[model samples]
Target: MILHRVAKENYNLLYSIGLTGYGVGMVLVPLFAEFLRQAYGWRGGLLIISALMANIIPVGMAIKFESHKNSRQRNGFQSVPSSPQGCNEGTESNSSTSQDTKGDSSDEIGVVRTIANSLRQSDFYMDPVFNVVFGVTFAYNMVWSGWHSFLVPHALQRGISVRNTIIITFAAAIGNTFSRVAAGFLTNSLVKPVTLFLFATILNIAAILCDVYFDNYYAMLVTTCISAMSIGGRSVLNQLVVRDRASPEKFDVAYAVDQLSVGFGLFLGGYLCGMIADHFSSYDATFKLLACIDVIVLLLIVLVRYRPKSNPA
Candidate 1:
């Protein structure tokens, strides 16, 4: 919903901030958890974290919607008239015309009814761009979730100390934070989001290979950092792809559908990767599999017919 309201130019930046917040949480939570647990015990520490989570309510409340009229005027865009009850007149007109032509009396109801009907239309699912976006999004989420879920365990299995693993993870979190913001800036100033996304995918493959073969602490640290950056960039890049392909009116629904893909990927990726690791008796095979999945994601991204609204700098 927030993405629908913002100008496309700012989408990458705002989304990057959101991703950065996640990275910050990843870094800070572990750092604070032990201290909090030592001071207040596990239950009390968890209670404190829960209390902190409530802060999001106030933050959400702070996001006020801009009036459509004001937004249109500010953007120097023409205002489409609204019906007396605040429904978009153009939408109503189209809906009415379609209803009359098709003799669909069910759609002649209220504004909400018409909107709901439009939302349920199969056109979105049939869109090639949407399908490609969904595929890449799903693949990216799968690899990301699987890696995060198992990276630490893999490190320990390979004879890395818990202390070094924690340090590597913290470094990765920092890289994640910076990379998300850098992706936004680069997208805005240096490259198309799709190009950046492709670059990230290639970088991730390298990182995965390093993780599979390297045993040195420094090498693992480098791999974690590179992997974090590449993975972090994907989050923003995927949203930009969705924004570029979706019609303005359908952006919210398209994004929601994309999120569903992410959820599916997260669940399946983690489970499948774990299963593969168990069967192979090594995380190396899991990393290689993830790299293969990234190749699929890269191909899907290439198939997207992206048309950016602005010229790339």
Candidate 2:
């Protein structure tokens, strides 16, 4: 909702910064968890986290919704007034008050009607652009969930030590942080978001291929960073695509629907990847299959029309 208030050119930048925070959290949380465990044990750590969660309520309350009319007023663009007819001052004042009341009531009715219409509309599900974005988002989430669930186990199986695995994870988080910020700038300055999304998908496919084929510790570490960079920009890109494809009034609904698809993908991806590994007796085969799915995601991205309201900055 806050993002909907921002200009289109800056959306990716803001979204990327948000992703960078997530990357930072991924790196920081493990270190913090280890410290808390050492200092006060797991029960104390859980209590601390529970207490911290309460802060979110106040933070959420601080976010104020700015209406479009208020935004225009702040910009000094007031509504034009009609010419006054030859009437007594008392009659004019009464007429103005009645008009204001009618206007307010009509606005309320219009809002309710739009919501009712949206509830009955199947056009959103049938839209070609929506279908493409939905498919790509689902695929991306599935791949991401699978990688997160299996990457550590896969590394351990390949004979990497616990310390080196942690180092690799740290390296990936660093790559993810930088890449998300860079992706935002790149999307605004160099390429259409859809084009950037396609490139990200390609990077993911390459990273998965490398993970499957490489046995060397350094090589696997590089693949890990590549995969992280690829995953970092995905959520931001998903937001950009949905905003571009849907009307401003429908953005919240569209995003909610997209998130639902993503949740399903995450569940299916994690389960299916584990099943594949069990059947093949290796993570390598599972990654190879993921790479194939990424190819399909890339193709879907290619089909999505990049019709933004404004040109790239």
Residue 195 shift from truth in candidate 2, angstroms: 0.9
Against the true structure, whose lDDT is highest? 1
TM-score, per-candidate, Cα-based: 0.79, 0.78
Looking at model 2, which ten-residue stretch has the lowest summed lDDT?
304-313
* lDDT for each residue of candidate 1 in 138-168, tens digit (9 for 90 to 100): 9999999988988898889889988999899
lDDT of 2: 0.82
lDDT by residue (132-209, candidate 2, tens digit) is 788888988888888889989999989999999999999889988888898888887677777888888998898889
Model 2 regions lying over 4 Å from their true place: 6-9, 67-127, 305-313
